[model samples]
Target: MKTVLITGCSSGFGLETAGYFLKQGWKVIATMRTPREDLLPRSEHLRLLALDVTDAESIHHAVEAAGPIDALVNNAGIGLLSAIEGTSMDLARDIFNTNTFGTMALCKAFIPQFRQRKSGVIINVTSTVTLKPIPLLAVYTASKAAVNAFTESLALELAPFNIRVGLVLPGLAPSTDFGKNAASRMQNVFPEPYEAFAANFFANAKNTAVVTYAADVAHAVWQAVNDPSAPMRIPAGADAVALAAQSL
Candidate 1:
């Protein structure tokens, strides 16, 4: 059976993707900052490991423990909803650390192994905001946008070794913990002048009917990992799909 190592299996798309892979008869190594055995179904093909993507030591340890894997899913990420001026350098750096650097670090850890094997897949979970600009998510967009570029470039470089790179651009998921986490950390987000705009934007976003779900993203990741000829960027939701079409 093929093995896949996924990051950020604590919840949302990561958790759902892990379950999907397990159901498909693949050995799954689900890594999260805090592993909860109860979160996933009990299966002999499943293993849970603790991983803080932002911490180098944690990533190194987790990858070492995961043994050989056929695919790497870079799904661990944090959301930020703050204006540029209001967002401190530290806050911006933190967002990049997890969403950008963390994914790259994990890729670096596995690249040698993948090259040696001459076969592997890297699926990165980015955001649709990179395709369509959003107001309050400038920082978040920038971070994911970097990953989009990185994936595209890496795909070209890794093609010689037959390693595939894919990107999943998921739309806004109001029902997921991502919205709650972003809201909870927005205390220092908007300046006084932009408060009204931020409020209206969020309220509209929540009430919108075009939100994506964990399953949709998980399926997209599965498709990306399995389809060797898949596009570098795959839209994982209705909203993202519509936007991507318009872009073309």
Candidate 2:
């Protein structure tokens, strides 16, 4: 059976994707900052590993433990919401560390294995915010945007080796803990000047009727892995598809 390694399996898209893969009868190595067995059903095909993508050592260990795999899903990420004026350099770096560098690092680690095997798929889960820019998310968008560019270029770089690279752009997934997690990182990030605008933005976000679901992302990843002819960029949700259409 083919094996797949997925990051950030603790919650949100990662967790849902892991479950989907399990249901498909694929051997899944689900990695998160902390390993939790309760999150998923008991299956011989499932193995959980502790992963902190931001740390090189942690990534190295996870890769070593995961063994060879047919696909790598870089779904692990952190969120940040704040006006540029209020976003500290350290906080920006932290956002990039997980969303940008972490994805790149894991790709770098797995490319050789995929190259040697002459078959593998790399799916990077990015946000649709890159397509539709908005206030208070400049840093987060930039971080995900970098992955989008990287995946596109890397797709060409690795095509000769039969290693497929694709991007999954998910829209606002209100059902996930994304907003709550972002809120934690946004402490004191709303300067007095941007507070009113920030409030308005969040209020509108809550009332937004269209949103992505974790399953939408899981399905997109499935396509990217199973369909050899799939496009490099696949928007996962209704809003994401609409935004992608508008961007075109």
Candidate 3:
């Protein structure tokens, strides 16, 4: 049985993806900041580990513990919603630390193994905001966009070794706790001049009918890891699919 290591399995897309992999009879090493065994079903194929993708030492330890794996899924990310004027440098760095650099760091840590093995797959979970710009999400969009570009270039860099790299761009998923997780950073983000615009944006977002779900992302990640012919970028929801089509 093939093994896969997935980050950010505490909840949301990572959690769903872990479950999907286990159902497919793959050994899964699910990592979170604080490992929780109760989140997933009891399965001999499942193992949980503690990981903080922002910290190099944590990555080292997790990689050591995970041993060899057939695929690596970089799905751990944080969200930020704020106007540029209100976004402080520290806050911007914090977003990049987890969403951008964290993904890169994990890839760097695992590339050597994948390269030596002459086989492995890497799937990064990004956001569709990178495809179509969204107001109040400049920092978040840029972070995910960087991963998209990085994945494309890295795919070419590793292709000679038969190592595959791909991206999964998910649309807005209101059912997840992304907005709530970002609430602290989003506080007072709307300056006086942009208050009306921010209010309207939230109102419209609440009423939007099309949105991504955790399962859609899980399915996309599965395909990216299992299908050698899968495209470099696979949008993972109805809304994301539409945005990707329009962009093309």
Instruction: Estimate the overall C-alpha local distance difference test score of candidate 2.
Output: 0.94
Worst-scoring 10-residue span by lDDT in model 3: 181-190
* Model 2: per-residue Cα lDDT over 105-195, one tens digit each: 9999999999998999999999999998698899999999999999999999999999999999999999998878778788899889888
C-alpha lDDT (0 to 100) for residue 156 of candidate 1: 93
Estimate the TM-score of every prediction: 0.98, 0.99, 0.99
**How do the residues 187-236 of candidate 3 rate in per-residue lDDT, one tens digit apiece?**
77778999999989999999999999999999999999999999999999
The better-scoring model by lDDT among 1 and 3 is 3
In the range 1-248, model 1's lDDT, one tens digit per residue, is: 99999998988999999999999999999999888999999999999999998998998898889989999999999999888979988889999999999999999999999999999999999989998878988889999999999999999999999999999999988767887766766786789999999889878886888878899999999999999777888998898888889888
Which residue runs does candidate 2 get wrong by more than 4 Å? none
lDDT of 2 at 161: 99
Superposition TM-score, candidate 2 onto the true structure: 0.99
